[model samples]
Target chain A: MTDAVERIVNLALHLAHAAKPVGHESIRRDVFGYPKDQDEAAYLRMFERDKDELRAAGFVIEANEAGLYSLDSAATFVSDVGLSATEIAAVRAAGTAALSDPSFPFAPELRLALAKLASRFEPLEVPAASRQADESPSDQAENAAALELATRASKRVEFVYTNSIGRTAAHTVEPYGLFLRDGRWYMVGRDIAHDEPRVYTVARMADLMVSGARPKSPDFSRPAGFDVSAFIRLPFQYGDQEFSAALRFDQSAAWRAKGLASGLGVLRSEGDETVWSVPARDDAALLRWVVENGPGISVDAPTELADRLVSTMRKAATLHG
Target chain B: MAKTPASERARRLLAVIARLESGSEIPLVDLAAELDASPTELASDLETLSLCGVAPFTPDEMIDVFVVDGMVEVYSPLPALDRPVRLSMTEARALAAALQGAGFSADDSLVQRLEAATAREFDAAQAERIVRAASGQHAKGVYGSLAAAAGAHRVVTIDYESAGGAGTSREIEPHVLFAERGAWYVAAHCRLAGAERTFRVDRIRSAQENGESFTVDAADAAPRTATPSGDLPTARVRFDAAGDFSARDWPGARLVSEHPAESGDGDIAGPKAVLGPLEIEIPYAGTDWIARRVVARGGAVEVLSPPDVRAAVVAVAESYSG
Candidate 1:
């Protein structure tokens, strides 16, 4: 119903007339997933519409009684053109998480939204946001059921929450939105208990069922002086705790950190190393940040944190040695 | 019950439409009888045909004309009809989704093959349009082709579906065939194995040479025969009250009673919440299924049924612990 239809049609016409006796059945099955006999009506209709559409679209579909419906290239609805089913899958796959879907709509959703904006797609070719790939068949079915439930009720959820790392926790949340980022999946919502907006990793969720409680989103006034732009760019979330610590990054790493700023850190430069006064509460998260920054960055303050960094570096060195 | 050549009739009628549009006219009685359509049906087809065109609004639409004095004598080349064979964006989306689900895509060479095959039936733009909107989960590659071969009594070579991906390729006499999740699979007698084996067509690496054919035994093609020993054990898990906190996480798991007499309140009322030391089983094959199921349950579900399966889940959980 969106832009994907138009683009795929163009692609299909190109495929149909690409070779001698174009194999339309392959299109129906590979592209359309319909059985050969089931698409008979389609074949009939093709005769009625081929010329005008083909010529206009530049596919040059001819009709012959050989090949699939025709062998003669001239008689087929499509003339010489190129590509295969797998290649098209690869192409169309980029837009939808269903192609590379892992779990949850975390970052993949952002990427899909950004990608869509970048492409300037024909509204008709706008494909459905793909589902995260790697879901077992039954999981897909469950997701479908969940989506349907969401569409029908327009409410929040109480689900056994599974973290991206496969840790399980239970949360009662108002389902606000669903998105896919990279290959990961996430569902954004207001945690009903906490009454704050939170995102749940979908693949981690076990007993997921959409709640029936319908709560209308209130009139939104952006929180006064809230930094929306900074929030959007920032990746990691700071929990209840905040840390004021200093980091010394080498010039090369500092330049990359300042320019990219993919995630956290209150970045500032001092001397040779850029002194980043980063805010991360606990040991687990702080450790993660340090590891990601690589060997160049060193924890200057908080001897415990610095020790952790040194120990981590020592482990890396041992491995390499 | 015969197929009664319904498809053939549908094919014939479409041909007549194509011929008429291409400026060929046929006698009414002859066309009607050939199509097995009654006089009224033929008249209806003609009436529908009368309305068919790019639309008389544009001079090009009015360019084609036909006169029915006594019988039906159609005339002139009608440009492609506006109401010609076309699919909606929704339909196309379903198709694409289905194909994608089945592991087919438009960029592959098959897309071109599909175009050529359906060319006689569909115009380039229309076909392309339909395919672009298409979405389905069906593997129409080697699997579908093999199934077709099996139906034709053709012996084909294919890898057997076993543990480590695909097995060695062997010549097989494919008999019974079925489709699972839009992919073709055939249960056939493998010459080497001398036993009936189910083969996934997509796993086949080479072209299926239509070897010396044989007859298919119709009686053996029943949908699901009872197994020799139907010992399909459902996977079960048991966890204490600590586990019950995360009970809702496991999909398809029904929390049974730790206490039969006492009732639960709210959603947990009437044994909705399985008490600690609970038992749950998920029916499936292989340890992978158990691992996935157990992992999904997280801290809530503990394995109780099928001791080996429980052990497998514990092992999988331990792997994650590291």
Candidate 2:
């Protein structure tokens, strides 16, 4: 491992410093720690490994059949993120808020990256604001790391995943991006088996491995104009269809209900109860909310939903009985 | 998993070079410590520096490395190496999502800063989609003040409405303000209850910061202990496979056991166990909280014990008519 790292470092420097594209013969002669003379196989293996590592690190090391290597001119390090002092503070504060959530997997990398960026400016006071919500804990460190790696490398990943329905299966996907929605991390990618795009909840995944065993070779390319959000279809979409559902929250749970309904649908107050009308598409979601809030909330409209709720309640009552 | 020394060293070497290119003379020890390396590794890095530079490889063109006494001076003057690197699109996207998740609107100052700081042209639509809140985005002023109070450790009187629709005034020493499921909450010491509490910030009607300050101990502010007093009364329930994920959302909820799938009943009228059963224990302040939940979920869950909880659930379920 040490030798591999050292070779990559040396090769990167050699390519970076070259006035012109450095040929393989020149690299072998000038760069130290190359295979001792007459071991062509070992030298080629080491060279390929170094090239891959450097490319993965964001160095655009170009090579051809003739073994000429050059760093992409535009790929050199630049000092200007163009952030003002206030911008740095904002980024720092955002980072701090993210770190406060114990389940965030990328905290270490975030801290190191932010420190480097902030070192350019005088330390700024982190704006005191509310920390981010700690959602239900999800142990997804390995998945998170794998997604990060594949996303950066533009490579594919293979993983064994279990869906909510309890079906576990293996899949290979070309990762487009990773996103967070509703406090959950999701990976948007193209499923190889299905030959179409899919969104995966990171928490539901297990045994993730990034593809592209060889360096500088990507397993797949993201489709043109691929939108991560466009491909994602959440299983439950309230009020997305023809069902217009109205729920009434009595005074007892009105305040908390309003908080829950903050920006979702039209809410109005009538006497002590708050009446909300939403296009109820999923029964389970609303049911969960109503059940959690106790008797203070009721489905007043869409008799079908109300009937379902009552029947569901009756089923639950039998369990306790 | 632990990072391999090779990968760790590669990361540090890249970071060190990038830092030095910012025209800063970094102290050898400070740089080494930041990289989690020893002075010996720093020397090795300097030795490696001798081999790097752009074309012609002349002394002047190469990165000059000097460790005089304790300071490491590096001069490359490489245009490629001089500037602060742009935020990678992934990093920018993640930051944007987190900032938005914390309830910052597109017009918030921090959001504006983020837009300004991002040097590359990010897809505005993509970024918007990533950060858009599904619901319960906070009112900016209320969120900001509470956050400030918590950071400053100020005791403040707040008019808060409880889940049961009761409003009360209490002096709370704000320790931490966080969001959970799009709702903002402040974990604090409530003087009225004389116990630690987590108050939903949005439900707080008004806040009057007291000039007085207080100290916060880590033990006192532990999140598990921050449950508001009213959510009392511990109850245990078993949820079939389909409901296991959501059941864990309850405060202080834990999985106690898992039961094999129960076969169907001979009678079609009776409830069928849809999925394998999972037994979970939860500490809840209100029986109504559990009762309503079980009633709503229908045959999916069952309150295993605590006759009072069972009765309450049965009552609520019987009250609802289709």
- lDDT at position B135, candidate 1: 24
Error of 1 at B193 (Å): 9.4
For candidate 1, give the DockQ.
0.04
True contacts kept of 1: 0.02
Q: Where does the lowest 10-residue lDDT sum fall in candidate 2 chain A?
A: A127-136
Q: Which ten residues in a row have the lowest lDDT in candidate 2 chain B?
A: B264-273
Residues A247-276, candidate 2: write the lDDT tens digits.
898776566565566345689899988898
Top candidate (lDDT): 2
Best by TM-score: 2
- Residue range with the least summed lDDT across 10 consecutive positions in model 1 chain A: A119-128
Error of 1 at B92 (Å): 5.0
lDDT at position B322, candidate 2 = 32
Write candidate 1's Cα lDDT for A36-92 as tens digits.
464588654653343333333223344566645332234432223243332333223
* lDDT tens digits by residue: candidate 2, B145-246: 565566556788888765443578999987765555445567778999888677766667677777888887765444433333345666778776676435
